[model samples]
Target: MRVAILASGNGTNFEALTKHFQSGDIPGDEVLLFCNHPDAPVMKRAERLGVPHESFTVKECGGKEKYEQRLLKLLKQYKVDIIALAGYLRVVGPTILNEYPDSILNLHPALLPSYPGLNSIQRAFDDYKKGKIKETGVTVHFIDAHLDHGPIIAQKAVPIKADDTEASLESRVHDTEHVLFPAALKKVILERMNKQ
Candidate 1:
């Protein structure tokens, strides 16, 4: 399977995916790495891994529709089979979601329907402090028009310890994401091949 990764941050998950692909833990290859931020660390990771990388600024595109159009054009140019969102902060528009449907996957730091947006780990910690939340976890799901409301493909819980700080809980959640994301991608690739 040919995969493309979209990221806007430090790219820890991106690094994990590339490491797994390099070590043969995942059968697919990362054909491209695209970043919205020019200085995103994922671009450096892609360079270090010798994978082709591209960048586009949402500002340059003038609007979400035009930006997504450019993105879809690039995905088509590479014949990208799967688009993985790794620390990609933007909510993908309906156009890409409609075109790819279940083919686009996102890795969320916390379990679904709980802490759905940015700073999920911190939000979970706050909720726990207020006695509103009992558990926190990572979720891998397909992308849809709604934010983080797509069908969940995989999830793994990370218990919040009584004395756990936000940073500690976040670390655990990220570790789980690193493990679960690759496994889910591998399964998706295998399932696609089987259907063929």
Candidate 2:
């Protein structure tokens, strides 16, 4: 499979995906990294990993339509088969989503139908404080137009510890993501890979 990672944060998950797709169990022909934020730490990780990366935000491209047009052009140029959204903060527009369809996968920090948006880990911890839940988990889902509301590919729960801080819980969740994402992606890729 030819894979590309779209991310916006510190790039730990981006790094994880790049490395995992390059070798280990499920290898790919090439793995690329693209970011909306040019200066995000993930760009640095991309440089360190020797992965080719491209950058341009919606504002940089002038608007959503233009931005997605540029993104679509790039994806076509690379012949990307799978788009893994690791930590990308932006909601993918219809253009790219329509182009890629089920080929795009989103990694979220909390189980679906629970904390679906930003600060999910913090929200889960807060809910625990409120005695509303006992555990939260990571989810790898096929993204649609909605935010983190898509068909689930895989999920793994992480129990809340009484002594655990929100930061600690986030750490554990990230660790789980690193494990779950690649495994789920391997399945998705092999299952959906276009037949020659």
Candidate 3:
């Protein structure tokens, strides 16, 4: 399977996936790393890992539709079988979703159906502080038109300790995401191959 990664930030998850691929633990090729920000750390990571990287700024595009159209074109050009979003902040428009459907997966820091949007880590911490929730974790799900509403492929809970600060809790969640995302992708890739 050929895979592409889209990220907007530090690309810790991107690095995790790359490591998995390099180790031959994941049964797929990472064809490219695409980012909206040229200065995103993921781009640097990609260079260090010798993975082909590309950047497309939405600011350069005339509209959201055009931006997404270009993105779709790039994905198609690479013949990417799977698309992974790591710390990708922008809402993916319909073009990409309709083009790939369940093929695109996103790693969310907080457990889904709660803290669905930005500041998920901080929000979960706040909820824990209020004694409203007992646990928080990571979720890997297919991307849908509705933000973070896609079918969940996998999720694992991490307990929020009494002494846990937002940073501490986020650290655990990030660790979980790094572990879970690769495992989930490995499953998906194996399942697809089995179907063939």
Candidate 4:
């Protein structure tokens, strides 16, 4: 399987996915790193990892429609079979969603249906601080049009320590995502392949 990672942040998850795929521990070829922000640090990591990369913002492409058209074209160019969103913040429009369908996956920092959308880590930590919740975790799921409201592929609960700050809890959640995302992706793809 050929996979493309769409990311916006520090690219730690992007880096993890690249290494996992390259190591042959996972059964896919990570052929591209697609970034919505041209200057995102993930592009730098992609260069170091020797993975081909492409980037352009929606504004740079004129609008979301045109941007998605270009995005679809690029995916076709790579013959991409999967799109894994690491930290890509933008909502995926219908064009790409219709093209990839269930082939798109996203990693959310909080155990979702509770804290969906942005700032989820902080929200979960706040809930914990208020004694409203005991733990927060990571979730890897198939993304739909709804933000973070997709069908879950995998989830792992990360306990909140009494001494844990938001940063500590966030670090553990991220680590869990790094592991879970790749495994969940591999599982999804393998299942898809077998059904073919």
Tens-digit lDDT track for model 2 on 1-196?
7888899979988777767766777666545789999999989999988999999889988999999999999998999988999899999999999998888999999989798888999999999999999999999999998888888999999999999999899999999999999889888887876553
Name the lDDT value of residue 97 in candidate 4. Answer: 96
Global CA lDDT of candidate 4, please? Answer: 0.90
Tens digits of lDDT, candidate 1, 60-102? 9998899999999999999999999999999999878888879
Clashes of each: 0, 0, 0, 0
Q: Where in model 2 is the C-alpha error above 4 Å? A: 194-196
Give lDDT per model, in order: 0.90, 0.89, 0.91, 0.90
Clashes of 1: 0
Query: Global lDDT for candidate 3?
Result: 0.91
What is the C-alpha lDDT profile of model 3 across 1-196, one tens digit per residue?
A: 9999999989999999999999999998999999999998889999999999999788798778888999989999999999999888899988888888789989998789888988988988898899899899999999888988899999999999999988899899999999999999998888988988
Q: Model 3: which ten-residue window has the lowest total lDDT?
A: 56-65
Better of 2 and 4 by TM-score: 4
- How well is each residue in 131-193 modelled by candidate 4, as lDDT tens digits? 999998999999898889778999999999999998898888888988999899989878977
lDDT of 3 at 169: 90
| lDDT leader | 3
Sequence-dependent TM-score of model 1? 0.96
Better of 1 and 4 by TM-score: 4
Q: What is the C-alpha RMSD, rounded to one decimal, of candidate 2?
A: 1.3
